[model samples]
Target: MAGVRKRYGGKRALDGFDLTVERGTVHGVLGPNGAGKTTAVRVMTTLLRHDEGLVRVAGHDVRDRGREVRRRIGLLGQHAALDEDLGGRQNLEMFGRLHHLGARRAGVRADELLERFGLMDTGRKAVKLYSGGMRRRLDLAASLITEPEVLFLDEPTTGLDPRGRAEVWGAVRSLVGGGTTVLLTTQYLEEADQLADRISVVDSGRGVAEGTPDELKARIGGDRIDVVLHDADRLADGAHALAHAAGTHAVSTDVDRRLLSAPVADRMTALTETVRALHARGIEARDIALRRPTLDEVFLQLTAARGAGRPGATERQEMPA
Candidate 1:
């Protein structure tokens, strides 16, 4: 969608949103709460209409070709849409039949999907008996009943444990490997960093930034040095020493963790000078390490900038579950 706009009364839900996704790749959309991530996905999937600008899906205009767009795309919403009374195979077969696959064809497709998602062992078990990961995998398989060209997964890993979330990640990677283009909106930053080849960061109903994970990290600066002080009282001193060594005053500190952090231009020189400065001040550090900026920091920095600059900005409504 280019220059898309959707309004609810006086408030614009989507304001000049733009997104470009490459085929056969996972593109991640990220934003703070009420920043229009879900609204954009709704428009692209033909679930919502925009008041202005061009919106298309699978090469067909969504405004005039909603049917064509729906035919090529599938959606797995935030909530599970499975019936606990039905077994895995029965659920998949039901979905296939609903999609207009005949009885024989639906059964065959159900069997195929069950095996593909490694649910063949539990295919006969009731969905309620399945694990969270197994049930989500079954739901994912059902969404592919028609072999759609594109799939929209909105927070697919929500409410899942670490293991369960990993299971869904593996399934998504396999689908992209088999040539499915996926547009993913997730609350977990690590999930996006793991699965997305490229990412788009949105805020205030607009596209704030777009790039690969590494590229976004680069935007916030590079190679941060974190020093965990052995003494909490030495926090201020450590921050000052590191700031002088790094040649920048943008030092951030966490008093609760007794941590002092700053960005460094030259890794080796900065590390060497930091140690010397701390030792000269007789300050003891428990640990020191150099690493790249995290996605969490990038998200906070980007969104906070936009929120601070806008006049009369208030928290927008979150998308419906």
Candidate 2:
């Protein structure tokens, strides 16, 4: 996308947004609610036209070559679009036909998808009777009817239980295995961390950060060290000792919980040194652990920077779970 813009009166849905996804990789578009995520996908899939800038999908300009672009892409929106009155197999068959597959081929493809999605037994059951997970599986199967080279999944696992989310993740892995390029928009940070080859974090109406999960995480700092003391009264002492050992203002003490958390530039070596120092001071830790910062931490740091009255601030409010 180039200089893409969309407006609803005074509010801009997408403001000069741009994104580029490489082929045969899972590219995650992440953002909070009311960000341009949905709007960007809409423009890329030809569902909504951009007021400015060029949009392209699968090498076809979305505006001028919409039909060609549509033929190369399959889309699964945030909500499943299965017809409740139809059987799971029937829904896939109908989509196959819509993709221009003949009767015999469409039926065969539907059966194949049903088996692949582990819904062969329920293929004859009306989608209305299907559980949320099963319905989402069928919706995904329908989207794959044409076997398009590019797939657009917008929060495909939203509202799913853990098992359902796992099922979707499995399906995404399978798609990537088959060399299908996927453009996924999701609010789930873990989902993006687990599946995406590269991530582009969008907020408000523009891309805020883009990189691999590890690279993004590394931007915030390094490993974290947490120590729990036997007595709450020792928290302040532990904080001071740990902070002194770490050579940085890395300590945060929780008096009630008797916990001290400190950022260690090198946790493996620093943590052991801190533990030895505490022991020498006659302090005993009930528990201790070293951990890498998660994507959530990185996101917060980046968004917080933008929120601090920085130039080009566009981070939006967090998305609803």
Give each model a TM-score. Answer: 0.94, 0.92
Tens-place lDDT per residue, model 2, 1-321, is 878888655667777888889999999998766777887888898887778998888889998999999999999998888889999999998988887899999999999999988999999999999988898888988989999999999999999998898988998899899999999999899999999999998766778899999889878777888889997777777888888777678587887778888888876788778888798788889999898889888777766655543323222322212
TM-score of decoy 1: 0.94
Model 2 alpha-carbon miss at residue 169, Å: 0.3
Best by lDDT: 1
Judged by TM-score, which candidate is best? 1
Each candidate: RMSD to true structure?
A: 2.3, 3.4
Q: Give candidate 1 regions above 4 Å deviation.
A: 308-321
lDDT (Cα) of model 2 = 0.85
